[model samples]
Target: MQPGIIRLSGLFFLLIGSALVLSSFGRVDNAEKDFSPEQPCEWVFKISDKSLALFQDKLLDLAFETASSIPMNPHIKDRSRAQETVVLACLHLDCPKRALRYMDQIVDWRRGSCYADLAFYFARRDCIDDARRCIQIASQISESAEDWRRDRIRVKIAQTYVWLGQNQQVDEFEAGVVDSELGKVARVKAMRSDADAFHEQMQVLETRMESGNFDIMNNTLQAYTELFHRFYSDVQKRSLVEEKIKTAWNGMPISTRIERLTDLAEFALEHSDSDKALALVNDAQSLIDGRQWPLEHFIPMMGKLAALRFRTGDRQKARSEADAARVLFHAQKDTIVNIWKAGTLRPLAQAYQTMEDPDAALSLYKQALAAGIENPNSRPRAEDLTATCLSMALYAVEPDDDLWGQAHRIYQGLDHPW
Candidate 1:
């Protein structure tokens, strides 16, 4: 209300808290919706908090009631389920800050269980210190530390920081280089050393990939992709990376080899080096066929291959490969597949659209949107979901369904940090 108000943002919170609920509810014209898991929670996944504000008070009441009823539990699963109810409800109320308040009162869900969630919300609100605090708490806690999902979240968070650090390093280095004549001389020497440094980094990444930790390999590959671009600061440095990448792939495990090749193939495709991309894709195929990768991995690799074939005017083979990928994906249990289910469909749909098959493309887009809607943790791939959802929303202008609303929810998720 007043300038220079104290209370560590209490007044500010009150104003924001009140306005968002009013603004959100007022903007929407939906009838009173039922508040339950099957409908309400799924609604949270489909609609933005701004659109859910009409149920704000009801959601907070249910959230508090749910958390209070569970008090404590010996089983982490039960406690987790209870906390999830509160979190989901708070999300709908447009009060993630309030969500953390309830999360803190639980007093039994361990520590890190809520830290990651809190860090994400606080980061979105631009409360850097609070987000950093949650990250510290998350790292220090051991509860559910062994869960693969938690580890994946940690790796993702760590990568964000590393990315920012790398960008800062590059900016500083470039600024120093441009500051003086001596800096120009230093850049010449630094470029030579960077080539050697790039090779060394690739070796480390190769070793990590060979260690057989798929998650680690994924993260390392992400970093390698960024660092390779950065280290190759000159034409000479850029030319040096390709040979080292080739050497590193030599005799590596088939999975690692395929990963390297897939990366290079994608890079070449983006750079319009069609021959290089096709050659690498060919090399990756034999390895892919030899290994039994999950649908999550296999579908993307196959889809990329099909797209390359499509580009080369091999329409027959492209359609065949796309059909094979769809069949294999349909066979996968939902518990094992995630966003990749929808992700692979988008590109295939694009290819169909390019081939003058709008009906086929629309069907695939619908399939992709459904897959995204079904996946509970679809926010990790909010980008892809939003793209596919946009296509679906545009294609289906039916009054009975709300594809546009679904697309809006995904776009909101994209606005938040993963």
Candidate 2:
């Protein structure tokens, strides 16, 4: 061979060797062993360092081993895909440093895939700065991405903002996507409604403060009470809302005590904090028992006591309390109280079932179903209880019966599958 050609061949071999070495290092650092019979050489990657840590703490090695069963293309030319895979592997290893390094590589790609994945990764890490950067890049990429991808990116961005305590930003982001290319009509509508209601309530409270209209203050408090009830499942957000309500309530006259207790009990119930609900109910009961309050106060306290008893697995006591509450509600002609009273019967039936009294359970279940049918909207939860009771009754009679089949059929008959 000519001298120049020989030199060129040597240079080419050197370059190829360097590339091969780099690629191999990348693979070894991210490589996961797969012992599954079905998918050898495949790597399963996680994307959250905290989640990986949790899995490790739980000693869920089997899950990690199973995830490693997926295969990768050893010679794939896409460096971005390789980086993504590495990021996932590092996450699975609970190595945030390595995961962030690969995430940077993907961010350099500046594509929709990179933006979406990196946004979620940063959000999971609670790195708000990186998450915001990812959101910006994602927004730019979203202009050219598919509609579904854009919608997903928008929701992720909103969620990230929510995590960062930028709730107003979440509102703005959701509003922009409401009727836009994103197809999240229902979520957008609900969020917008909540934001609007919260704002309106704030305004009403401000106005009442200026005008000294205590009657209007009642309306403002009620609005917030309802709003908190509607969104109480979210602990952090509910805490913030409750703080605001308490601050406002404390500034008002002592005459608002009963209403405040009522609202707090309702909030506790909505959040599934049965202990808190019971405590608030007891506070109300003290006023009634001391003759400082009326029979109406005792009514709500009795209902809450029944609910607390049922939650604590004391169904017999719960049933007695609920029966008394039912009579009081009927005498007062309070539909809301009646609804709560009817709610107790279903759980009472479950208590009977637990006590091995199927006959009593069946009778209570039938009564609950009849009450529910008469006031469908008021007892919206009764259908599920009815189905449960029917299924349990069938099982107690004959363990081999097709109770599940019947239950499935009943679920299908319902307009909404709740």
Candidate 3:
């Protein structure tokens, strides 16, 4: 998966759902005293509206230019998915025309899904004609797709229709689905339609897994995570979601649970629930202290956990965690494969920045940029560099003159799609 896209996906969901819920509490500006730049909405809100628009334009331009550079090949699909992420982001930012330029650059089922998402975007704004037009185009693309790809696209179309409250259209696409992957697609369609049914099925699945039935599918757990957050405000629903997630992770490796807990902590922080975020971070820390993991997993998790701890107001421990991660990074720097060096360093840099160590952060950022350039695979190399640039831009990390020149030189030389 593209790290660049992973970072952007959270923003896409926040723009569509969380922003509205948060507005009822008050604009992000009102909560400035309570939050730091660690919050995504707050960070973007800190920027002037004019600057935000200019940043959006620059991001889309980068995405489009990257997409244009990709050569048509079997592997091009993976590269183009990063551009697809930017298209969704552009639509959320009210840059629909720019989004369309990158839409056609995506391949197969993904392109159809992008149009379906665009249709949803338009539908929410009451642009019914444009919504329907995009849905028709998405449906046509789905029809031309073969086998499992067709069902995948249809699932996106059906979900979009659900959002549009077009039940007839939803059912039409649902009926056309052919079972694949042991009817997982059918289960996804059913689960999406009924929350109560999803809850009941999750209970049953959790029971079976605890009793030594085979592991739950990763996608099933992912679907649960996505759906459960919508009901996070409901006390009983929140309990159920927490139980399911913990149970699902029970038998996985400790590192996996640590990672998930850290992610849950970050998600809680996004919603401004500091108490819950701190609890999740404590749980992850317990796991971290219980065993020794390979440096690969341990270092990144420490970097992330450190930033989260700082956000939760545990400044002393956060500083210690960051220092420990920095130490481990130096010790293991030569042993880490070139492709993953930037991935590891980026988070460490963020942790330092969060801790108000700009000099250290700046040094690490430069090291990450250099490491990103070491990857032989052009596409992934570009992705690593793009992810670093995105983290700097979105989090308000200011580069000094020397680092700015270095980044500009690297970006100008990038010719492959990220």
Candidate 4:
């Protein structure tokens, strides 16, 4: 761990300095538009939503209990996967002890990766001792991993060190990736390094994206996001990057296009660029409106669109969209599998919550939990139950005792949650 590791939110400010602080004008969400010196991290980390904090302690308790209740799968691979899922959920809930507990059960190289993530999470929270312990464990595990896996784990560790602002340790960890082009690009972003060098990296990434490789496509989008944030004030550069992103997205499937555009739209919202966010949202909306996708795909996407719409100050359209989605959901509910039903319901509930309709939100959340009960398959049921629990924990709505009890029984009942 770094000797002078500061808080994550403070480090973010230091990274950008005063010159990059965004104006709060045209903010659309319910959060106070102006950035406070006390909460600078909120602007960059969506998980820092105040609503989540309100329920954080309860969420962590439920998360730990739920994780403990899940039965271990007989197969090592399956067991590791299940543990990884719970570890990730625990991390998201800011329950590092529980995360580490589950992560220790993981039996694959991924356990090393998870440790790196835990280290990053700890670093963000300024938990230096815990972060150092996880980093040591991760390094030890990486030493015995296959060459390729070791390299990947090294990159993850390097990234964590970068987050801790430990330049010396970052250089040491990143040394293993000196020959890797992708690693180079990743390091640049992790270190908040030279902007001009990223231009060449962006070109390489864009060219790879043209090949339509899914991983490269995602990397390209992430690169665009990094560049967009880095050069947000440079209108000409931002426009050029946006144009390239749009061009790249043109060849993707309609669903993929909608998802990617909305992700960019959400990023725009984070930066208080409501106009850009709306434009991107509109682009996604047009695609959703014009396309004829399967109802299963359509409903969930619609739910997401409704939430984004509400966030962008189009509450009326958002409500209309949610209503339309609910009707479609009912029309096809019988045919939809329990997994998809839960998926669809959760987002719809989120939309309603954002719109300040607590009753509607609570009802939808209950429905989401019930949908998992309808599943005959044990694994999907367990997955759905855990996810619903996590969602309920994060949302403003408090689940009734009955709902939590039902989820607890389902988690305990599963013999193979993998």
Candidate 5:
């Protein structure tokens, strides 16, 4: 062959070899040529389930390893399905950290489908800025979203605002979405209308208060109290709601008194607010005395006082008040009262445990469990109390033993879908 021709032949061969090598390594010169748009959603859904299960088991390290082995950018259909699975899996695992990381990828392909889930995860993690950004993006796509899914996303956004303490946002969202006939009718129908709408309204107001919307707090409380009164028709329960609303209104400027009082009482018993909680409890007691509130009507307040006393290092007073509440609970023979009684035991047990009375705490926990079981409607409370009691007892005795196994079994037996 001629010298120039031989050189050209050699260059062509080398180029061909390079092309062959690249093909074997899954590389392509043309991006669209390599893309497979026909990929199905099922393939992505399976991978998502596996990933979510691993995450739930706290096997993130393993999940990462598996994800690393998969192709980086699959076909859009496959990618969209995979993103849905991954988003749901992250939610199930309560791992918002992972969800946030993968969210961009999901949104780049499928926007509206994952917004509600992403919003919920972000809200739960208290990632306000990111959540708002996600909401804005989701809102744009929401017009094209499914009706049920859009409603769900709106609710999630409203809840996120609630957690962020954005009272105005909550009100705006609720008034625009939730307070509509559709919203009220849907939730009311969901709860079967047997229960008062006040609980749901209170939840909204509490969310607003939590978001720091104090301006509307009193009005919300009044509205809530009226709703409670209209539903209960029981003079005592109405009076109780009225009293609580009054206290909430009175304490408005002084630090969202209801929230502060509850927090102080809880803090006094749990962490660093012992003295402050005691003082507040004293004030509450004085107020109760001044009003001559009926014992049945004032049990919850007394329970708070006892908790505050226990936190303030007043063991005797705490125990006395707890015992009094317990007696009143039993005497009333009211299922609602029994539920409160069961709730009271939780604090009493904590107090006893704090005073180094493990035996007493354990006993009270057991009693609480029994009380909870007696009222079938109180199964959730019973289950929780039983779990705590078992866990605590196990820690107090032998951590290595399978004490939690029994509690886990009981928890599994319950009908709670979560």
Candidate 6:
């Protein structure tokens, strides 16, 4: 791994960084938003990075016991885990729609982790109402809105610049192409060599960010985020990004390292350097874990890991990572600031399709599509995703199921969904 590898979130719900959650953000339900758990909640990653996997695994085991109505073995821990066992048991026993009822079991829903987990569960199923409720409950326990807004604005802007650099649009240098189309091809190379030529303009706009031209800042940010992601993922094909450009990137404030490290991670993958991808991802997770950022921030990274694991033939690990990606994508279903590249979901979706879970693959494809729409500059990309998803649906879905009709509808109704 290179210097300044990003540290990802320790929690694996899973994509916070790069399945950069294939992310969705929406309001939580209010009716069942408040509840009290047997004890105050604690984040699982804070306890063990493996805790989430264990929770799900143990839940399945506990389900068998619950089905037979057997007592769970005694194990010392927090009441939250036991409560989660029961709640998941409830959902397992045909009460998926009654997720809210289980929410009532938690004491002070905002102060506990169960509500959040449940919210994530509902989100995976696109149970927006229940997910929203869980989100509301979790929000109640977080930093005050004023403080969060302030920090988010600061973080969002840094993220914007980092993304711009990664998505820089420039063709690779080719002497022959330049000779053939002097002005056009050579100009493209010039742009690549002077990638930061926009720095002066960016500085001007960045200044206005504090002055409250948020729309301009956000719109500009969206445009640049897409560009930077593109540039970083494809950079390995070239010899060097300008040295000054590299210096500025490496010299960026630590606060902005999340996006930079993430792009580098993708860049590593694009170069077929799985070892580097793994190293960079682990480093980024360390950073993410240290920051205690929201779970959404972890998604893309986990998704990246999922892709890596799948490539390395660790099917179980890949499945676990992909599952985490799916959960986070649904749970953190809001937030326009994505640190991961677009198309990050394709591999995971393809993995699922390979595993014969067309439904899961289709969902991920749609999630990626939704994420792609956040940037107006990535419309072509959005179309790429659409085309990919449509093709997947057409080929992967079994004709016997009603999925073909649904796929046909999607192909007709939507612009693009990969």
Those runs of model 3 whose alpha carbons end farther than 4 Å from true positions after fitting are 1-56, 88-97, 107-109, 121-130, 171-216, 226-228, 253-256, 352-362, 398-400, 412-418
Cα lDDT tens digits for candidate 5, 1-418: 1111111122222221111111122332232132112331111111122233321233233222222223333333333333444444444444455554554444332445355456645654556666676666566554444444455456555555655666676555455442221232122222122356545655565554443345455335534433442444444644455455555565464323433344334433433546645775675565566554444345545654575577687778878877777677567645454434444454445555555666766676565545544434323332333334322432232211242343333333444221
Query: lDDT of all the models against the reference?
Result: 0.46, 0.44, 0.60, 0.61, 0.43, 0.39
State model 3's lDDT: 0.60
lDDT of 6 by residue, 157-273 (tens): 222223223233212211122111222221112223334554543344344334333333333332233234334444541223322223333334343444444545555555677
3 versus 6: better TM-score goes to: 3
Q: Show model 5 residue runs off by greater than 4 Å.
A: 1-260, 263-276, 289-300, 313-316, 323-341, 354-356, 376-418
| Each prediction's number of clashing residue pairs | 0, 3, 0, 0, 1, 52
Clashing pairs in 5: 165-211
Quality of model 6 by C-alpha lDDT? 0.39
lDDT of 4: 0.61
Off by over 4 Å in 4: 1-59, 64-71, 75-79, 93-98, 105-107, 122-133, 144-152, 161-195, 210-212, 415-418
Ten-residue segment with the worst summed lDDT in candidate 1?
Answer: 16-25
Give stretches of model 6 more than 4 Å off.
1-247, 250-272, 292-301, 312-316, 328-359, 362-401, 410-418
Number of the predicted model whose lDDT against the real structure is largest? 4
- Overall local distance difference test of candidate 5: 0.43
lDDT of 2 at 301: 45
The candidate maximizing TM-score is 4
Candidate 2 per-residue lDDT over residues 195-306, each given as its tens digit: 5365554464445435445644554555455555556675665566566666666557543655456556755754678777667656645544555433333543454445
Q: What is the TM-score of candidate 5?
A: 0.39
lDDT of 3 by residue, 182-283 (tens): 223323343344556666656654553454322234334444454455555666866777778787765677765765576567667766788888999999
If both were scored by TM-score, which would come out higher, candidate 2 or candidate 6?
6
**Residue 68 Cα positional deviation in candidate 5, in Å, after optimal superposition:** 33
Candidates sorted by TM-score, best first: 4, 3, 1, 5, 6, 2
TM-score, cand. 2: 0.31
- Residue-by-residue lDDT tens digits, candidate 1, 178-229: 1111112121122233445665665665665575454444444444544444
